[model samples]
Target: GAGVSQSPSNKVTEKGKDVELRCDPISGHTALYWYRQSLGQGLEFLIYFQGNSAPDKSGLPSDRFSAERTGGSVSTLTIQRTQQEDSAVYLCASSPQPGTGNYEQYFGPGTRLTVT
Candidate 1:
């Protein structure tokens, strides 16, 4: 893919509803990350994936938030029992490697999600 791509750029749903956000990272990139951005706030790390190993999901706000990377290319972020507080821009990013000095991550446009 050309950079990172997120589907359904904008989403609106009821408070109890669930949503699945998709991300396709840049081809050949070995590291993927997910973040949440509140209005006028900086991005907060949610999860990170390196190759096919287990993902780092320590940043997930609650058990309702989860993510998984499939085949080291595409990833899905699932928010269950969505709450109004969950409204925010979901961002996806990728880098060639993880923890290498000077590594830069390219971010996706982001998916704006709203819970009514």
Candidate 2:
């Protein structure tokens, strides 16, 4: 029973460069979420994926940010033309059920992105 995991624990990239952050959710979990935490700020919802349905991209900040879940397992968040404001800790979480209501989500260590 593995928990959610994120890659490149720390990422240092130049502004305007593109970066791809990866996440592996717990096996058989029907719901997955992506969030970003900026300095001194609360967690910001970025996206959500559940089973075979279309993902919820409403939380994404802009067109520069996008994500995809493959086979309902691994997901990748791509930040194109990275900006200084995009620097933050990217967190991944998964739950056994769908919706953001009462289900408990297990979180990963998070990938820290630094734009320099």
Candidate 3:
């Protein structure tokens, strides 16, 4: 019954570099979400995957950002060509609901990325 875990806790990279952040959600959780918290953007929903369905990538900032859910369990978010503007807290959450409820998320501590 692990809650949720994200790696690196913090990351620093040069502009134009790429990064991959990992998320491990609670066992048996059918819904997973990715969000970003930044100075300008309070909390932006990035992407979501639920059960055996196609992921909702509507909130992805750009084509450079993509995510994949493997085996309906683990998910990885990849950011290509990072930029200074991309520096922010990358958070992951999981729940039982796919497209309902404001309580459909349980957040991770987030990966703090700094680009320079």
Candidate 4:
């Protein structure tokens, strides 16, 4: 599939540990986003990147959560000092453009992170 992809499909870490998640978007996509989904909950937006624009990180739950897109293609999400409440599935999505009439996001299967 020529869509978004995520790495380390599953991760288990102890509290206070640091973890990094990876995402690779489709070629040429200019808009990338990161989200978090808790069990039985809807996806919560985490961050957004569009072209060379400043990334929108307002959705990050805390200073511990951060992300960056490099070369406008690959992205990495980092969680510092993991907490039990941080256990969730991290999802990545990308779109060719933002808010176009036909604009839609393609989502990756997601990376599941569990903190113990």
Report the CA-based lDDT of candidate 2 relative to the real structure. 0.95
Model 3: how far is 8 from its true place, Å?
1.4
Of candidate 2, the 10-residue stretch with the lowest lDDT total is 96-105
For model 3, residues 1-116, the per-residue Cα lDDT tens digits are 67899997999999999999999988878999999999767889999898988889999989999999898877899999998999999999988754555565777889999999
lDDT of 3: 0.89
Clashes (N, CA, C under 3 Å) per candidate: 0, 0, 0, 0
> Which 10 consecutive positions of candidate 4 have the poorest summed lDDT?
95-104
Question: Once superposed on the true structure, which residue ranges of model 2 sit more than 4 Å away at CA?
Answer: 99-102
Candidate 2 accuracy as TM-score:
0.95
Error of 4 at 94 (Å): 0.3
TM-scores, one per candidate: 0.94, 0.95, 0.91, 0.96
Tens digit of per-residue lDDT, candidate 4, span 7-115: 9999999999999999999898899999999999999999999999999999999999989889989999999999999999999999987667658899999999999
CA lDDT for candidate 4: 0.95
Query: Which scores greater on lDDT, model 3 or model 4?
Result: 4
lDDT (10s digit) by residue, model 2, range 1-116: 77888998999999999999999998888899999999999999999999999999999999999999999899999999999999999999999865547589899999999999
Report lDDT (CA) for all predictions: 0.94, 0.95, 0.89, 0.95
Which of the two, 2 or 3, has more TM-score?
A: 2
The true-structure Cα RMSD of candidate 3 reads: 2.0
- lDDT winner between candidates 2 and 3: 2
> Can you tell me which runs of candidate 3 are displaced by over 4 Å?
97-102
Error of 1 at 50 (Å): 0.3
